[model samples]
Target: MKLSDKAYEKFKHHLMMGDLKPGQFISQRELATMTGVPLAPVREALLRLELEGVVQIAPQRGIQIVEVSLRFIRDTYQLRMMIEKEAAAKFAGNASEAMISQLREVHRSVIARVDEVGPSDNLLKDAQGIDDSLHDTIVSSLGNELVDWLYAMNNQRIQLIRLAHGHLTLITPGTFRQVMTEHMAIIEALESHDPDAAASAIEKHLTAALHRALGL
Candidate 1:
């Protein structure tokens, strides 16, 4: 990877890992040190981040990380719904039967583990992976690199918001079950080859996720 891309990835890592906080201001040199990249690469990374709305660069002031807001939450989720619902519809029509079956089995396995163990660390980690995998699969099925890129950027912001709000570690049994069940619903629709049902399920699932992200 290029130094600037490395710097960008490192910056995102720190942001998601809570080392770099939202609304915090840091000089470019500080960012360089934090990312272990030189100042020039860090500057290039900051410009990209600024364009993505991940950070703001001011004239005399340092770079400021974006703080979570209601608008941000709504906008991110809205974009997710727009992209993912279409992806779900498309995936329902084109996804192989083997892939659909595997998705169903994995979701079922996670749901069973949650029921039996009540959210152990390992189970939670598995659940998080399952959650990410399902969405990633649906989005990648769209086969549009630009859309994929935009979805990834939006997903980073969504993850950052979730991390900031304690959503990552505070998974309750009920919440986990609901999420898995929602995934199963989408999977079922996909298996049935009903594009409309798949799209509707995705929309419903994303709507619930939006409410949860807003702490509703």
Candidate 2:
């Protein structure tokens, strides 16, 4: 990848992790200082981020993070639902026994992390991690490298939304717990190896996520 792309990813990673600190101004010089890279790539990243609508470039002023809006959140969930529901359906008929077993193993690891983190720590990070595993498992089962690549690219935007919404308090007595329940339902559907059921389960899962975003 180009150095500019590398800088883009570094900044993007920190932004999506919510590590940039809210309401902070990001200058190209500051980025270079923090990342210890030179100026060119950092400037490239800033221009790209500006074009992507994540950053605002005032003519004489510096870059600021754009407001996290509901429309973007809804769009992210819509795309995730559209792509991942199809993936789940594909996996139901296409996943091998061994692949399912592998997914089960990944589930065990996730459960272990949840136990270690007490279910409330780094909620966005954990959700994204689980989403990655589930999505990758399904896409790989479909045996489509092109689809997998597309999914990865889209996942970056998803991560940004997750970070932006991380402070929205999802793990209430009513939200994340319900979301977890829906996720479990999805796993059950996949284990049953029924395409229609899997698709339904994914829709349910995505709907629950939208509820979290809606504060419902």
Candidate 3:
């Protein structure tokens, strides 16, 4: 990998891990040293992170971690509801053995790491980039091309907005634990090959996530 990519990979992990707290200033020199990259490459990586809304840059003060916006919090949860509902309804009708296996695997992996602690464990967030992988896989398995294309494009914007908002992480390890039992409900629905039940589970899951984020 290129030095810039390497730096980004390293620093990105830190950003996701919350090791680099929001509103904290990050120096190019410090990042270069920490990630074992050169100054130029570290600078390049910082620019990329900045563009991704992961960090804010100042002329001489270097980069500062940014808090997520409330507007983004609303939009992201809204997007999740719109997209995941369609994904659930569509996938419910055509779910196959392979798809069920994959969904089960995601559940197991996430549950296993639920108590692992550290970076990998911090991924228990409700943010798009973090957990939407499972939801995206489910949606695509439905073989709906239009939903697939638009979801791919919009998911990034939603993820960016999600992480840009600080308090939004609460959407995950927050009270939403009660809400996440719906994933198990989804699994049961899929096991029975009941399209309506599966769609209901996913729809409720998305709806609850949205409402919780709204504090409603």
Q: Over the stretch 123-188, how does candidate 1's per-residue lDDT look in tens digits?
A: 887888888899999999999999999998998788768767766323555588788878899999
- Model 2: per-residue lDDT, tens digit, 1-216? 788888888887777667775346777788887666689888888887776666777665677776556776777678778778888998888778776776666666655666566566575456556666676677666667877766665565565655667545244423545655676777778789998999999898777777777667
Cα lDDT of model 3 by residue, 1-216, tens digit: 999999988986776665676568878888888799999999898788777666788888878876545675666667666777666666766778887877777765665565455224246552224355667677777577886766764554454444444354344555434644667688778778777787788878777666655556
Q: For residue 202, what is the lDDT in candidate 2?
A: 86
Top-down TM-score ranking: 1, 2, 3
RMSD of 1: 1.5
Each prediction's number of clashing residue pairs: 0, 0, 4
Displacement of residue 21 (Cα, Å) in model 3 is 0.9
Order of candidate numbers by lDDT, starting with the best? 1, 2, 3
Give stretches of model 2 more than 4 Å off: 21-24, 50-53, 105-128, 140-146, 167-176
Q: Which stretches of model 1 miss by more than 4 angstroms?
A: 168-171
What's the lDDT for all of these models?
0.88, 0.70, 0.67
Model 1 steric clash pairs: none
